[model samples]
Target chain A: MFRDIAEWLANSPAREFSAGLLSSIPGLPPILQTVHLLSIVAIMASIVLIDLRILGLAVPSQQLDEMIVRLRAWTVWGVIGAIISGILFVLARPNRYLLNPVFQIKFILLIGVLILTVCFYRWSAKNPFSHEPGNNIGIAKGVAVVSLLMWIVVVMAGRWIAYSEYLFWPG
Target chain B: MLNEFFLWLEYLPLAQHIGATWWFPLMESLHVVSMTLMLGTILMVDLRILGFAANRYAISTMSSELVPWSAVSLTIASVTGVAMFITRASTHAVNPALQIKMLLMVLAAINIVTVHCYVFRGVVNWDAGKVAPFSARFSAGCSLGLWVGVFLAGRWIGHIV
Candidate 1:
């Protein structure tokens, strides 16, 4: 099923156009990659700050709710930019990404992290500690640690995509 | 000459090992991790100074809390970066993208010092919920642009070579 989907995407007109355009440009792929990386920096940094706050390790003077509000825009825009750039990258070479196990792992990690992040945000919004300044809830700290670890894995998986050929791949 | 030194460095056992083994990709991954941490923290602080984000927090407070993470990440990044460079020191040393990245880093350091010694000294006056003075904002803007340039140049090094 996965191979079929990848094959279909690879043969799609959109992919053909994207591949042609990306190939025609001398350095467009790297430029898109740069943007993708920049967006990752934004996302990772925002996540780090929020997680640190929950762990009582950073910005102790600021209220959690307020801090979340402050970082929301950065996180939202970063995700938007990353998604757009990531889709373009896949469109440029659908099979290269869609069929790669490492890419599949990265995609899974990204989805998991997004869901975790949303749930954590919603939970914090309702939690009392969020309104209280410098107060770190135990549950939130646990979640923060998990969140940090998951993000680290996501980033590692992202870097590994380039070297996926060395890893276990049946095809 | 510096080229000879780089060549010598590249021949070192540690550099040779990194060049020959799987260590290169591992170190490269670590480099990316640290880069995000360093850049991310710096971005927040810069955005704060520019009155674009986290306005309610005092500039000093945010800097004090966040800069340490940025500093630590910078240290890790520098270490991994040097490790990677030594593996192919002569080639990296001559890479124009790398040279530009290094120069940008120097400028960034200078900008940080200028902020600490000059713009930041007056931070107390407009530290919280206020637009910082033009000098401070200008420094912050420069910091943002320079760091972005550094990242882009660093990325181009692989392609350029």
Candidate 2:
């Protein structure tokens, strides 16, 4: 059954799409994964610092905007890491990855993270919290909370992909 | 000594299941992902402290802000790391390398805790002499060394004992 599905995908649009990606970038995928991992490390640090602040675990005296400014470079680095690694990983084994449900979920969560970052973190060097200190209570907190949650899921799903056996799904 | 450790850690149950099937590969990948995620965050924070970047942004601000994310990332890494451990309980439980790794982890955790406690505890005490106190710098440096050891030990599990 799995073989048959693989065969079908071989002729399908996805196969062509994945093949095209590989053809376009011969040795880029592995390099992307390496860089991606490194960037993720950087981003993770920035994110946790900010998130910890949100949870009030440590260092509450600093302004939220100031924190964001400092974290910006790292956050940007992290996003770049995740995106490139993800694309490269996907390209390396597109059909199998696309067939997996976990990948789908990961992409969704990734989108959520991106959206959250964009919604609140637009400026290259400004803080969203300073304009309305008290109003920064609920939604701002929710954004931070969900951003962390989505990243967790994304990492889990990425790992789960390696473990999954169900390749030919929704046929 | 290393060979003897190699003999010791490759116990029966785990020895039988190191590469038994597809699940091991999956779990291993998950373990990598979880670790990378955690390490990723750690790198950012430490870099900030070292003044690699984020100079304008106060250390306290960055530290407080990243606290929540760090907690969550670490939680995920620990949970997945344990799951990986369960897959090979007996051998890993007694393995010298794992023991060393665990010790390093404890040390790392202590450093992190100190950062939050005595080091970062008085953020409002910002002063001319107050960029990152000696204690904070030492903790950060310890944190880096411990985590590197952790990563190296983890990868060395395949070759080392």
Candidate 3:
């Protein structure tokens, strides 16, 4: 099913147009990649701040809601920028990413993390742990640690996409 | 003299191994991770100084809490960046993108010092929930721009080479 979809997408005129456009422009891809990376930095930084607060490691004086409010714009815009650039990347070479197992892992991880982020926000909105620090942090800390680790792995997998062939995996 | 130094770096066992094996990508990944961490923490603090985000928190409080993370990540990034540079030291040593990155880093350091020694000395007066003085905002803006330039120039090194 995945192969079929990849093949269909690769054969599409949109992919052709993207491939042509990306190739026609000098240094466009790297520019896009840099934007993607900077957007990732924005997202990672906001997440780190909020998670650190949750873990009681930093900014313990600030309210969690206030921190979330301050960072929401950065995270939201970062995700928007990443998605637009990421789609362009895939559109430029559909099969290269669509067929690559590392890309698939990255896609899965990205989805998982986004969902986790949403769920975390919803949960935190109700619990508001920073308000009652040291009261009930076990669950929040677990989620924070997992989110941080997952983000780091997502970055690793994203970088590994280019070297997917060199990846060692048990067959 | 610099060429000889780069040559010596390239011939080191660690550099040779990294250049030859998968260690290159591994180090590159770590470099990116640390760079993002450093950039992210610094961005938050800069924005705070500019009264753009987290204005409720005192500038001093935010800087004290977050700057440590930035320092630690910068250390890791520098270490990993040097490890990567040594892999192709001769080539990277002359790379224009790398030269610009280094220059931008120096400028960024100067900006930080300016903030610490001059602008930040008056931080106690407008530290919380207030718009910073023009000098503080100006330095913060410069910090943001220089860091972004550094990131762009660092990435461009691979494209240039």
Candidate 4:
């Protein structure tokens, strides 16, 4: 499967465009990384703030609904940052990543995460968090745990990618 | 300090496989994906807590509802990640950037654990339209800082020497 992808990418103009576009930009990669980092930081900031709210750390008197509204701007911007940098990374090495199975799984998992997030975000639109804060402890804890685990896996997997090799045994 | 052990370990066949070809790259792609999921969900949860987006729902809804997918994504990324490490244990073990990344991961874990263990331990029933507790808010701030640091460290791994 990987072989086919590698062969196709090697032959395609897409690879040329990716390399050419990147080379022409000159210093683009580093710039993108910085932007990506900033957005990630913003996004994470908003998230932890809310999680803390679930945990009962900050702004106890404020309304839960109001807090979520304030955090939306950060989330949207963070997603945008990821998208921009993600494309740059993929474009730079399309064939290598396209052929790799880990990359494939990552794409699948991304889709899953997006689907689930939308579901929750949409649901919360109807029901506001009560002053009790502790009201829905199970749900809040679950989300925080899932998020922490997901990111750890992602970081490790990325580091691991520097090490993948594929070989098909002789028939 | 542990770099020596990792250096020795990188000599193993699996490490050779990762460094020799395309496996590590593949794993990296997955890692980035998991990062996005984790990032996206956390943002959503945090926003909800701050009364930004999901005001209609309860504070706990963010965890119970949106985080499961992110967790599954993490599991997938982690398994493949460990495999990558085995492929080049010695080299990465010695790499300073890698060490920093590992340290950041540990800190992030601790931050998350604190959020769960200390704050939001029980039911928080909203009165009219009140936010979360003070301690929980502080925990949220700490969580934000830790996760952002984690994300930065993870990305910097590409430039690791």
Q: What TM-score against the true fold does each predicted structure earn? A: 0.93, 0.60, 0.94, 0.54
Error of 3 at B3 (Å): 1.0
Q: Write the per-residue lDDT of candidate 2 for residues A1-171, one digit (tens) a residue.
A: 434555676676765676677568745444454455556666655665566567665446656677677777777877876776576446546567766777777777788787777766774234466676676646667767887777766766675675565442455
Q: For each of the candidates, what fraction of the native contacts does it recover?
A: 0.63, 0.42, 0.58, 0.23
Give the best candidate by TM-score. 3
Q: Encode model 3's per-residue lDDT on B12-37: one tens digit a residue.
A: 99999998887888888888888888
Candidate 4 lDDT by residue in tens digits, A1-171: 756766777677777877787778855655566566566545545554455555665445446667666676676677677677766666667776766666665565655655654554564555556643455556766765665455444434543443544432224
lDDT of 3 at A34: 83
Q: Which ranges in model 4 have alpha carbons more than 4 Å from their true place?
A: A1-31, A37-171, B1-4, B125-130
In model 1, where do residues sit more than 4 Å from their true spots?
Answer: A130-136, A169-171
Model 2 iRMSD vs. native:
5.1
Provide the DockQ value for model 2: 0.28
Model 3 chain B: weakest 10-residue lDDT segment is: B48-57
Instruction: Report lDDT (CA) for all predictions.
Output: 0.85, 0.64, 0.85, 0.61
**Docking model 4 quality class:** incorrect
Question: Distance (Å) between predicted and true CA of A10, model 4?
Answer: 20
Chain B TM per candidate, please?
Answer: 0.98, 0.77, 0.97, 0.82
Taking the tens digit of each residue's C-alpha lDDT, what string does model 4 give over B15-134? 788766766666666665556556556655665665555566677755675566557656876876777777767666766766776887788678678767866575365411337666
